[model samples]
Target chain A: MSTSSDEPAMGAKKVEGAGEPIPPGKPMTMEQHIVDKGAMMLQRLKPMKQISQHGCSFAIYSHDMTRQIETHHYCTRINQDFLQCAVYDSDGSHGRLIGVEYIVSDKTFEALPPDEQKLWHSHAYEIKSGLWVNPRVPEVVVKPELENLAKSYGKFWCTWQLDRGDRLPIGTPALMVSPQGVNMGVPSPELVRTRDLKYNILTEAIRDSRVEIAEPEWLNPMADYWKQHGKGFKIDVEPVDMKLRAPFP
Target chain B: MSQHPEVPGDPTATTTSLLEKATASIQRFGPISHIHQHLCAFHFYSHDMTRQVEAHHFCGHLNEEVRQCLIYNSPEPDARLIGIEYIVTETLFDMLPDEEKPMWHSHDYEVKGGYLFMPGIPGPVERQDMEKVAKTYGKTIHFWQVDRGDNLPLGIPQIMFALTREGQLYDELAQDVERRYKVSFAAEKEKRKDIEGPEMGRHPLANGAGKGLQTVLKEVDVKPPSGTTPRVFV
Candidate 1:
């Protein structure tokens, strides 16, 4: 996680002698020139302050509940409560935009009607379970963000189900939820390995960093309810290893 | 521990360099693919059964026919991501299957009432852009009902949209938004005079003209059962 001091300033190099004006009788096509000019204009007009960007990995489920897809999210925190994430099938620049996830705070979540509430899934499980992780960020930064996210809720819809060979966002939006409880599934081994290799850190290592952060009580609804009522609802269970499956055929 | 180690240099130079680095990173990730217009508006839940919850929308136009909006609770950063609204042209909407039609709501009421706006942009340009948006339909579903104060997202997702007609939006809600954003709906209405409102029909399944089919059917000029003389209209 190289911070500002370590990274070079953006476009600091001086433009060496302005390139010769395009030759009047150049062989280049007009369309090609227009595209080249458009790209430069877009770079100049880009909005900087309006967006806060971060990169992370998400373990998402298929629509038919058959496969667990490992997706990368290049998230832009538009504001404190709102994160409009551009989801990718892989972490590379070549990764296509497969879906988008909108995350809101508890305050915004309550404003929705009951039925609307159901469509969104809680992040408590994802955060508490240590499934959702930011491989790029430092542990210190990731810790607080996870603390905030643990208390937040998200409404995720995957547009591109790559397994089905769909290119564009076609068909109804599926309400994506994180796997719940101890026996819940894990992402594929290949996906995890690819992610781990990219970050140069193990998933277990990231999970270990969250040992001190207090797990929010709201994560387990039944347990929280019973605990509030002073009722003893205890279960003695063994912890199982998180095994990743092969990618869907 | 500081994320960035202090560099051994003049304090002013260090600050400038750091700011530039942060700026550069933001520039690299900020813009979406070919995003031209950024419009800010409001979306309200369509189901009359639920109390009105006003959701602020910051939308980016991907192209002529498609726009993806980031729905928020307020204009500020800490505002929650209540949901996402996908707006498409009439051609796209017409192509959708009949079953999917109910999920989408029209933008007529939102446009005409001046509740939906493209803030920061020029008045004429905003009006022109919104006119195109007004003709388009949106399919929106909000997952977080933050106004309810629930800790977690509870039940099923609810279909939502902007208030379509007069009196659908409360004066205080409009006033609050105007005050917070330092914008005037009355002035916006005046600016939007050039853009004519689209004529909407009583579509069988569509939430056209701001009211849903159930609400319309329930108040179909028929006499109320017993002594309940439609308190909604009054």
Candidate 2:
């Protein structure tokens, strides 16, 4: 399902801007911020990095170029929501990416496959109540797409370009799951919940209005994860203005 | 190799000029009447809403609330959420000068005035507290222009916001312009001349009319007519 070949780490700070080259650095945690070299605020979250030292690896992808990665999914069940994002590396590859679950509405959840009910519970298994827990992906949904990339370029992703003056705002990002996988829009089953104390604080953190971009805190539960294994990997992120329309096709 | 030549994207050397040549034939033409579909990005502070507005009023829409929902709810089958206005950035134009008044003016009171009136200097502003100068004072209104690829303050946005998301007042005017100038012009040209070729012809009554008619036409040139105040805000 994954694309082959793991390029050296990228230098991009905000992965949104096109034409900019990536710089380099090791991923480290500093408060909520994922401090690294040359990265700027992605406007997606206050502290852009969401790396956890736990077994689950969080992957992040740049929004600028289509860095090689495994399978991609066009979420069907979800009625076209928006996704805000940042980039992360796992397995130490620049593309050892994981998407820190992006934003979507509750109405987006009601319509999904029953298998997700079980899978989502698995992802949020560690959490307590009052706060909504994350959903988990079922093995059926995750399997084939979970296959490792030919090399090890993890998932690449980012949010929709909602602010435009000339065209229909772009839709949210698609998940780069494995090749043979299906994308059920905003998998309600696969989302994870927050620790109650951290939930309110993280919520406020979102509003306090800081910005972040890199971290390997979250994992896709898919294989080929490097962060969970505690391997030290250097990554790079940069902002770019990529005209996403295609002639490249 | 590819047999077809590449289509030109920059309109100034292409679309705009073509419209100009068809002033009399088209039913419509204007900035707002244009249709586009593209993508863009924008930023909005949490302050834009309130618990009085929303319970988590001051909480963030970015990392927190929305993500929380996504993490918890986990959409399925049809996960793609449809059209919803997440964060809207209506360009807030602040304190405009007299020189810029001829074509544009959206008043903003926060920047109070006292004119020293120096040559080529801009108009003045007097404020009680510079700290009080949050960006809340400016006026956000419908802005229009013909240049598509022009550099805009916000990066290139999607097509819906730029074309279809216009406020009501600008919507009517934009439609009027398009109908009268672009569409009607083409139809008229097709009726009277070779639709296959590009040409601007003499007026019906002026057919075979002399240089005098041509001179009168020059005198009657149309200005970019401004309509009566159309309350463009919702």
Candidate 3:
């Protein structure tokens, strides 16, 4: 994996002449120019080889899957049948090879840009809502498209809940995506209508399986990272290398 | 009115409101299970005969009547090490006895001594730490407080086998597979009534047709608890 640490890189490349430089106002070619610009941006992108367990977001659900679990990566869903998955290796701890996630929801992939999508497996995306792949199981379901995708692109459908609360929980090299799917938007569970400790009804309506964002604020308390700039912790890792991991076939 | 809350119904909605709803509904009927904020610290008393300390943690919290003195009074020093994982330490990782110690170097799960030991790593704190308590203070020990973070699993088997050394577990399980795959797994499906999955081996004896299902064999269910997916432990 290319380990580059750059974000919001230049969108165009200037062609230099002997004396004059042509402003990259418009690209000579669309695809090639875009690719070159992307490569340059990726190269110039400052890679942060550190991962924090904070500011991460998460979601969870259960569904079918039909793909062989490759090595180099692991099926972390407590219940594999439904693809309860999580991914949070971006903090540059082990680089990208460490925290590869699978079976992300359509919602998650939709948030990605085109380049980011290519960086992730093509077949990875979300599915229907309302279903839960409980945190304590080892089950899965395989759809036809998912099976083919897993075979062709090494991507399969998975259902999972991850805790991408923003920063690492511990605020160090240990970024954990519980895959329990933290709903940052989950309304604060009001005592609502409590007849007693035993009898009550909820007043506020919510969507999706609600989970209390323990961090309520997307901050991760654990990622109080030491200035590893000159530290041996993340001495030489590139950013993109910190994003993708090697999948064992 | 909206027919339903929406596709992604709030999971937090079920947190305690449903409990309230159920409890209220239950009160209308009659008194039920004592629903108090109870701490179920299940304890495994040190067996008198074995002279070994076996710590068995269940899906509960510590009770007031727990025997904390079982750390000593053993035939073999640290011979019987029973580990209990998933000790409801989700919110109390820092509350464990010795939370201030630092780990040398750890891979996968973080090392927390005084709590249940992970498979591969050395028992946190070494003998000196335990010796201090075992040799003095009447060997009083408290339950390990652990954090059930996202990566680690809190499953039954995973928790059950928490305290075991990783190398030891790997060796034993390999041997178990060898024996099963070599012998018991070879019996005919109709005859190998004991074997469950293809990975498992067949039972030893076919016996006869008249023996019935129970007499023939049984299946082993390695299924995890409901709701969650299986954890991929390193």
Error of 1 at A218 (Å): 12
- Model 3 CA deviation exceeding 4 Å by range: A1-73, A77-99, A113-115, A124-249, B1-234
Best by TM-score: 1
Task: State how far residue B176 of model 3 sits from its true place (Å).
Answer: 42
User: What TM-score, computed on C-alpha atoms, does each candidate reach?
Assistant: 0.56, 0.18, 0.17
Q: Order of all candidates by DockQ, from best down to worst?
A: 1, 2, 3
lDDT score, candidate 1, position B234: 10
lDDT digits (tens) for residues A1-249 of candidate 3: 001111111221221222321111122335423332333333221111011011112221111110011111222211112121213222222211112233333444344344333322322111111121111111132222222222211121111111221110111111112221122112122211221112221222211222221222221221111111111111011111111111100
Model 1 has an lDDT value of: 0.49
lDDT (tens digit, per residue) of candidate 3 on B134-205: 111111111111222112111111101111112212233334433532422122222322212111111111
| Model 2 Cα lDDT, one tens digit per residue, A48-140 | 111111112222222211222211121211111222222222112222122223222222222323322111111121111111111132223
Q: On residues A1-249, what C-alpha lDDT tens digit does candidate 1 reach at each position?
A: 111011112212222232321101124345433432343343332232344444455544422233456666555554345555656565542354455676766656656665455445567666665667665455665566677678777766664345443322333434454543422234556766766777677876667767777766553332112112212111111112211121100
DockQ, all candidates in order: 0.04, 0.02, 0.01
Q: 2 or 3, which is superior by DockQ?
A: 2
Better of 1 and 3 by DockQ: 1
Looking at candidate 1 chain A, the ten consecutive residues that score lowest on lDDT are: A1-10
**Candidate 2 local lDDT, B1-234, one digit each (tens):** 111122211222333233223321321211111111111111111111000000000011121101011110111221121112221111211111211111111111111111000111111211211111211111111111112321111111111111101121123332443343232322322332321110122111110111100000001111111423222211
> With candidate 1 superimposed using the best TM-score fit, by how many Å does residue A182's alpha carbon deviate from the native?
8.0
Residue B79 deviation, candidate 2, in Å? 11
